[model samples]
Target: MSTVLQPGPARRKAARIAVLSGIASVAVALAGCGDSGTPDASQPTPEASAGPSAAAAELVVQDPWVKAADDGMTAVFGVLVNDTTADVTITSVTTDISPVELHEMAMSDGAMVMREKDGGIVVPAGGSHTLEPGGDHIMLMDIARPVQPGDEIALTLTFADGATSEFTAVAKPFAGAEESYDPSTEMDHG
Candidate 1:
């Protein structure tokens, strides 16, 4: 009732060739594709924007990155550049991971506190706004999952004119900027 079958030498060779051919095909398909697994912090992301509008075309996020976090929340830092002769105001930020907020550090009771930015961030005409630790940043609240180093997070910035720009930011470990103004929740940065 049982059958014992073995492939012949030619059949075995053909099977090996098929497997190798599939691997080669995959390699060929992935050739020249971006995302090398390890992101280069110094270089801008190849796929920076998804669908840039007229206003978004003149805007660029340079060297964008996110702080690694196991849970809770994380922040994104980058250099927002405005190439046009008019100032660009980012009204809001949206992402798939969690709620996003434009946050800035302020002196509250002799301490630096993180709070929501009321009027959002503005990149001056032909200038740039640097989002760094303990400064202006894009805050990701209540992350659904862990954001480890080398991970990519996509975010969309809505300008005051209703134009939007999307970009992906790589995650890296950071040890600073752990203070959160909300006493009900703890922030994760390092």
Candidate 2:
């Protein structure tokens, strides 16, 4: 019988390295198996992307009415309701009737006065925000024409995310909402 030859130490070491390299190559190939360089259909499209905070919630104005005024300043009152679970902010308001400003009543110099609201009005998630007299309201200054009773005013509200919503507010007769920037004893309780 022929004598059997044993593997040298260097040859054994090279064999081990070769085996390990083969295993590593297989692992790398398996890792890249499923991805075909194609997009998955399960992923959301660009239009309907992300969570609630990614989109602005549309606000519904319920019982919207503007205080009837002839020429000068007046106010718009309503209950801004948000049906979505996301909270929204009314940053600014625009109308053809007059210049609009978001205002609130605050105590200044030991008296109650109307001032520009710091920050915008926030409508909570699945909740409501009131734009009423003597509290928080949209002030219409220097009206273009006389707003008599039964007139409808068109307004567009700009949200915090630059989204806009258009709504029509009916004019109603009201004797309240007389508070000014100066100190006034009269307060609008409406």
Candidate 3:
């Protein structure tokens, strides 16, 4: 006797159920692979980027110093650091000196020459400028009083952006003709 294994209704229903179950399983697996919309405490948060902020204007004076016992004149030197992104122009400079002038040193005919400057120094964006001896420096002419060591002179620097920065340039004896002065010198000016 030959038995015919033909597909029955029960077998067809089972096959459909198996196919549906397989599809449902695949869909659930795919959904699980995505984010669960929950925060993870184990991971660290990212830090904010470092850059200049709006409404933030700052000037940092480094190694600021003034010559002691002025020989009718004195000079101040420092590094002006503008942390703002905008261009900073020194519009005006004021000190105790009678005639304060901005001077620039240049080499002419193999000789160093100093000339009176019209405008103050310009601090560019994300940059710094130095006002040191043998370079662009501040000339304190006709010094009214002797600026000895440990004396602090108030210097008001006005900017083009309607901002004013006040710095205290400490007075100290010139270390040498080439060596720079220490901004934190505590010598007794008395």
Candidate 4:
């Protein structure tokens, strides 16, 4: 009988399996090292270069008006809306008429009265405040010129945060004049 000269079939099969296992181990090791290499050319950088990082808040003035007065003195009123993430304080007011002074209305001895307020108005974030006749208002004293209907006056409002908003005040007749003059109403007599 002829003897088997080479390795048996089972031994050859085992050798082939060992070679395949070695190749698989090498492939796994290479995959583990891939993370440490330089980044691929197709990938983006770490810093994202787009859009505004911080946006400023907006201040909106609504229905601004100035009332006619004598002795170069007048009253300015409006509604101020703060639509931002920061607190706003009206530090100073400037106008062509004159320096604006903050004023408040109060009752003295059961009589309506008005007085000067040194401190300015504070508007909270995402909130609104009002300056109107018979309330908190801006007093324009020593006007350079006369104001009439359809006249536009520029009022620069300076904020504590160093931001300024310039608003135009339209000259109009006093608000609620009819109600204020009606004889049948309590406000009319007061």
Residue pairs with clashing backbones, model 1? none
- Please list the residue runs of candidate 1 whose C-alpha ends up more than 4 Å from where it truly belongs after superposition: 1-53, 177-190
Alpha carbon lDDT of each predicted model: 0.82, 0.80, 0.69, 0.69
Candidate 2, residues 1-190: lDDT per residue as tens digits? Answer: 9998899999999999999999999998887667666665786554454334343445799999998877778889899998776788888999997998888888776767677786888888889989887789888867899899999999998888787888999999886544442223343321
lDDT value for model 1: 0.82
Candidate achieving higher TM-score, 3 or 4: 3
Model 3 vs. true fold: TM? 0.59
Q: Per-residue lDDT of 1-190 in model 1, one digit per residue for the tens?
A: 9988899999999999999999999997787366778866775555543223444667999999999888887889999998866778899999999889898877776666678888989888889999998799999888999999999999999998788889999999888655542436433221
Task: Rate residue 69 of model 2 by lDDT.
Answer: 77
List residue ranges in candidate 4 displaced over 4 A.
Answer: 1-57, 108-111, 175-190
As for TM-score, the candidate ahead, 2 or 3, is 2
lDDT of 3 by residue, 21-120 (tens): 9999999998776666764456333221122222124668788888786546678889988776665677667786646767776655665566676577
Q: Estimated TM-score per prediction?
A: 0.66, 0.67, 0.59, 0.59
- Residue 8's lDDT within candidate 1 is 93
Candidate 3 error regions (>4 Å): 1-56, 178-190
Worst 10 residues of 2 by lDDT: 181-190
Worst 10 residues of 4 by lDDT: 48-57
Name the top TM-score candidate. 2
- 12 Cα displacement, candidate 4 (Å): 66
Number of clashes recorded per candidate: 0, 0, 0, 0
